[model samples]
Target: MTELVATTPGLLPLPDWAKGELSDLKGHQKSDLIDGTEGEAVTEAYDRVRAEELDWQTEAGLDRVVGGQARWDDNIAHPLSMADAVDTRGIVRYYDNNNFYREPVVVGELTATGDVAAELDATAEALDDGAGDLQAVLPGPYSLADLATDEQYGDEAAFLDAVADFLVDEVEQFPDVATLFLLEPSLVENPPEAGIDERAGAAIDRVATATEADVVCHTYWGAVPEKPYAHLMDADLDAVGFDFVSDHEANLYNITEYGTTDDIALGLVDGQNTRVEGVETVRERVEWVGEQIPAQSFDTTYLTANTELFYLPVNRAREKLAVLARAAAGEEEVTA
Candidate 1:
């Protein structure tokens, strides 16, 4: 008998205590908060919380377990650890919504490989010994290019290629450790108006071909252009992630076009907002998407559009996700 698999969107929450600890560590240098917790105490706290989050996911019957991103200063810096050119700015902003602020460092060059691979290795080692569904998250090449300063890289294309090369190296090194390599292109919301560039496509292709692991390209926070979608379809990727919580109509259109060939990670859970969605609401959205493609053509995985770890209060965030889990199990209905 064939087994049916459902993915629940997961949250990345920082415990209240952890936040307090971070605050204490920041004392006078609040700006350096994001890059401040790289030492022993912070690492230990992160490990404990990450393990707890994974356990929560397992108990909730979630198909995949993210490392909870507990150790990351921010999403962008988490993957850029191997790079030598980047430096900590000691201060970070949410970049959107005029919400909470984050202390993330700026990337100095595209040629360096940050500590992403090491972080993934550590995270993989921390999960249950036989866990088969572990995933590592990364920022997309184009987005990294956009975030880099003009002083860092004279030619954006060349710099992007360098970052892509490093990504390919990282992907190839940990083929057996993770189930999926998730790439988040936050900048895709504002890509170059002309079209998808060759260098970007090539970088994605390189990583896809090098890793036996499934590659999922995720674009959230806004709409992705047709040219990039076209380019992604031609690349050697296994799936594409779309945020239903954000621009559903545009994402739906993209899914309709390429869902049959590529696996789809449906982001039903809102990552940035505090409101919890009911099962019925999520189910309706899933059902609508299911109608567009065969069940096997896509896999529904719940993910907050961005990291909930940074935005929501920890306890409230967990309670909200608890509702999502119940919904995924068909135990509750989304209230109007």
Candidate 2:
């Protein structure tokens, strides 16, 4: 029997209370010199938000929940930006969205900063004693290279290779978790140059294989082009996520023609939109995909938003999680 699981691409909108807490903390820091207490306060606020976000997912009946990446102000690039090799430069719009991140410019040879492993340990500590199966999120090699300003690595392939190797080092240190969502928006937003798709796939495979947890190479904004989709299928990923909410016709065609992994993530809900989807609506979308791909079968079908939920308000993001859980479990509405 195929298992239907509910999850997300990981980042979620910060709640109003958390925003207030951060604001107060920042104000305190501005008034005082750079002190350990100020940093601790910021971390304390993030911890609170992370725990609350996990609780939200748990309450919604999600099978595998993320820490919600509440501390990630720079979105997918945050983990790598923490490294000494990267420098924060001018702001760049994240995809076509209004969201922006301080562009991470590669200034030196890349290195694993150990931030991801520390974050994982912290997430484990934030857990409410055996309540939720933790999940981690990271920017995939392709997107990281594509999005960043490559000042260090002179060659394109070398830059991509370095980023992949850096990620592999980071992944190798990961404490076992339920899932690892490797966000690769560039595969859909801006695909690699011709004949380079296989190299990209190999890079992704290296990172995916380094971890024991199930890795989902999630692409969003639109469907991955046919050639890249074919190459992605060659990777060692457990599941390949597609944005069914945007340009899903292309996504459906790719799946039917090229086929995907035995386990797949159907991004059936709109992550950026405030309009929350209902159980039946999402279920119908899943059913439709199944109907279209009758020749192919999935061992596990993950119900998720097409992109990160940070674009929506916290309440709406929470509602989206509930809808995904409800749809997967065949529940018409949320239950007390």
Candidate 3:
């Protein structure tokens, strides 16, 4: 198994040329825009931004590259929009802060137009073409079901299974891409009122079983449920990502134990906050973890606790985060 890894948390600002009318929408005041009026124009912009972000990650010395999620509205909304399986009642918060509401779009039956595969391929091609490593991000099945309206699914378990199958189908489309398939199960941190652990586990299992890509299940926003980690262990995934900013001690304990099985995508940088971490502090943290696990037992990645693109201006965020990554890698000296 390959060793020593670092990552920037997923999602980056869409370039001006890709955003289109997505910016005109009431809540998307901070989106990037594509230059042309046509749909193809919008897609081309997405492709360009994806390629650029992958390049940035590679230049920053990141081992695994994320598509930067330039093609989606928000992180969770991307898969929901693709599945067409939710009804946004125009009152839904675009993010947790209630800054903007989704304009109440109805999710129709699930369909795969192969657009996702094309998007993934375009990103993979960009990375390969540039000789950069790349990874793809997907909204997890439970997260999708949690975001969808209860009225639409009737039974969340069944709905999650269907979405998982859809995700599996999409993932299989990119077999040769030497990238980890990252599943963002943001909703798992705060499950729906009607959700059960078993059902969510089953949904995740479906995706795990169907796709051959190395999987990295990520649960951001808060602490991950123990059951999900156990479920992931049972499945065929290659690693699990956890947010350490909020509960570092607990997460560190979890990683010390189960982290042996999979590479640990340790989110040391706080995505929600703009306060940059110092090099010495970050190095000490990484060294502490290294002492617990052999260099081979677990690998670490530097990432923001959440999507830095959502909170900070892109360039500033990238600059600050690059420092944090350098700190974690022991590449730079700590200053007073």
Candidate 4:
């Protein structure tokens, strides 16, 4: 059987303590909390949060673990907002969830203000060998463009290109990253207007080529429009991920037309759903995807949750994560 690595697209839900710590830091700076820790630090917030998450992921038998995205303030766009060219606006609802993020606005030419990888770099150093390789996540250029308002760039095409260029540099700063998950929920959630598919494809390719690590473009939320779906294969991605829970049939059906020589990461676990799925049920879905798209068509695979685990309660999210590991490993006789 093929070994499918189990991982997430990062942006993990804050553990109980981390949530409170973040609350205190809210409308404040992370720098203020550092000195105020005095030595105790209540686990120093994110440092502790990421450490705990790493410990849990290692214990759960995952093959790859994200750095917990502890430093991210708003759905992967937080770090980008810190740049001088981008303006941070009022809180806005992210997708269909109650969670909110400060909107990123393009006010001028986007530039990298600080090292985005610093926290993850420290987290990686703190992890034991048992913790799997650290995979970094970023909001896809097209999606980031859609999520943010463009005040400088007049046209959508230019804005998309600029965001992609900025992300190419941002992702390159991720030190020792093994895999990069370019999260693009907007592509499937709110498809772009017609005729921009080519630019979208280029946007994806730009960020992908910035680093040597295998880049995977993961789309979620619903069936992506056929226009953009058809264009994905032409992009320079090492793998393409599909949200099996949202509309697996359409995702599978569409991929066959613009098939790839790359690997296909299938998001089998439902991140938004509260109900836990058994290992066997998830395994069956994984098998179904394989039959739909022959194993020979792709080089390797990844089995992951359909979206960020933030939608579910922390405990429930972690439980589902373990199940993903079990299903990917083809384990049987799992217990609740």
Question: Which model scores highest in TM-score?
Answer: 2
How close to the true structure is residue 273 of candidate 1, measured as C-alpha lDDT? 70
**How many pairs in model 2 have backbone atoms within 3 A of each other, for residues 3 or more apart or on separate chains, i.e. clashes?**
0
How do the residues 1-336 of candidate 3 rate in per-residue lDDT, one tens digit apiece?
225455655677655545554444423322322211125545555667777777666656556667777656645556555444444445465447533434324355665545567766776667654444566667677776565564544565666776777777776775354445455545445653434565666677677666665666676666565655555556555666666666766666666665535456666666667676665666676666667656455543434344435565566556555655566456775232
Give the higher-TM-score candidate: 3 or 4: 4
CA-only RMSD, every prediction: 4.3, 2.2, 4.8, 2.9
> What is residue 196's positional error in candidate 4, in angstroms?
1.8
Q: How close to the true structure is residue 184 of candidate 2, measured as C-alpha lDDT?
A: 96
- For residues 230-327, write the lDDT of model 2, one tens digit per residue: 99999999999989898889998888888889899989889988998888999999898888888877899999999999889888888889999999
- lDDT (C-alpha, whole model) for all candidates: 0.58, 0.86, 0.58, 0.79
Better of 1 and 3 by lDDT: 3
Would you give me the overall lDDT of model 4?
0.79
Name the weakest run of 10 consecutive residues (lDDT summed) in model 3.
29-38
Q: How many residue pairs clash per model? A: 19, 0, 10, 0
**Alpha-carbon shift of residue 13 in model 3 (angstroms):** 2.0
- Error at 241, model 3, angstroms: 1.0
Report the Cα lDDT for candidate 2: 0.86
Error of 3 at 57 (Å): 2.0
TM-score of each: 0.80, 0.95, 0.79, 0.92
**Cand. 1 Cα-lDDT:** 0.58
